[model samples]
Target: MVTVSAEESLDHGVPAPMRRGEVFTIHATRDDRSMITHRILPEIAVAQARQLNDAGWQVHISELGGRAFKPSEFYQLLSYKRIG
Candidate 1:
């Protein structure tokens, strides 16, 4: 079995760090335990989103600007309005 690091892995090795909203991609796959592992394909986006928690970024696959992932059944996209 092979493993890859997260999208930001390369950035950490370079002298320059990534901005909070920077995006990158590597490869992603499902492991033998049926757990999905993100390989961080080098062409995808990894932008910061307040919608996310401490990681503060959103990662998803897309083609033609639409979701490439199978629809979620166990989770729903929660929406909230910033009432400030």
Candidate 2:
């Protein structure tokens, strides 16, 4: 019997449908209270991150439950920083 780990299964060729609660989190900070946003779509998260970056805030996008097969763990997907 072959036993596949949860992480391996997730990475398999099979495409998993996006769950309703699946979301991307945008974290932005700039010498102030950090702002966090949860977006269900990647495009929206990227847009928000770009906006934050344009406004001089450092931004990063993370997917919920994307790291170490832990539902509570977040895996960073992209990061943005304003360049002088």
Candidate 3:
């Protein structure tokens, strides 16, 4: 029989999907000190960004890895429309 510790078991575990309205902070690649906060729009915005084939857009909730989304959190920054 094999035994696994809690830390070992959690090592391969995947994170849960992000929820709506969650805030993701975007950092400028050139300037580490600069960051922009963005709230995740509805699911529809994600779908729409994908349909447009804009894969570079990403939504980062924290300081770590970011998830890709079309018309992503960054998109909101570029758009003049009010986001909820």
Candidate 4:
């Protein structure tokens, strides 16, 4: 028979995936500032930027999630920023 403590069991567990709009936990000093990132698609970002620009919102930042993937569906998770 074997027994495991709650702490031991939790230590071996993997963290859940980051949700769409969840703020990340960052290690920083009291005076430091950081961004809470979210995954956004590249094409969508571009289209949205153009739309927002036309509608009167100026975009200033955009970033991608990962590389151009094989399936291509994953490329949708990339992001971009533009100045409108």
Cα lDDT computed for each candidate against the true fold = 0.26, 0.50, 0.33, 0.29
Candidate 3: Cα lDDT at 20:
21
The runs of at least 3 residues in candidate 2 whose Cα sits more than 4 Å from the true structure, single-residue gaps closed, are: 1-21, 66-84
Q: Pick the candidate with the highest TM-score.
A: 2
**What tens-digit string does per-residue lDDT give for candidate 1 at 1-84?**
333354332323322212222222212333332222233331222221112212422223322223343223102112212111
Instruction: Give the winner by lDDT.
Output: 2
User: If the candidates were sorted by their lDDT against the true structure, best first, what order would they fall in?
Assistant: 2, 3, 4, 1
Q: Judged by lDDT against the true structure, how good is candidate 3?
A: 0.33
Estimated TM-score for each candidate: 0.19, 0.53, 0.25, 0.28
Q: Which lDDT value does model 2 have at 81?
A: 26
Off by more than 4 A, model 3: 1-16, 31-33, 42-84
For model 3 the TM-score comes to 0.25
Quote the positional error of residue 21 for candidate 3 in Å. Answer: 1.8
Give the count of colliding residue pairs in each prediction: 11, 0, 1, 5
After superposition of all CA atoms, the RMSD between model 1 and the true structure is 13.7
lDDT of 2 by residue, 1-84 (tens): 122212211232322223333456677779966887767545566776777778988777665555221212222232232111
Q: Give the poorly placed runs of model 1, Cα more than 4 Å off.
A: 1-4, 9-33, 42-66, 70-84
- Model 4 clashing residue pairs (backbone): 41-76, 42-78, 61-81, 62-80, 62-81
Model 4 is weakest, by summed lDDT over 10 consecutive residues, at 22-31
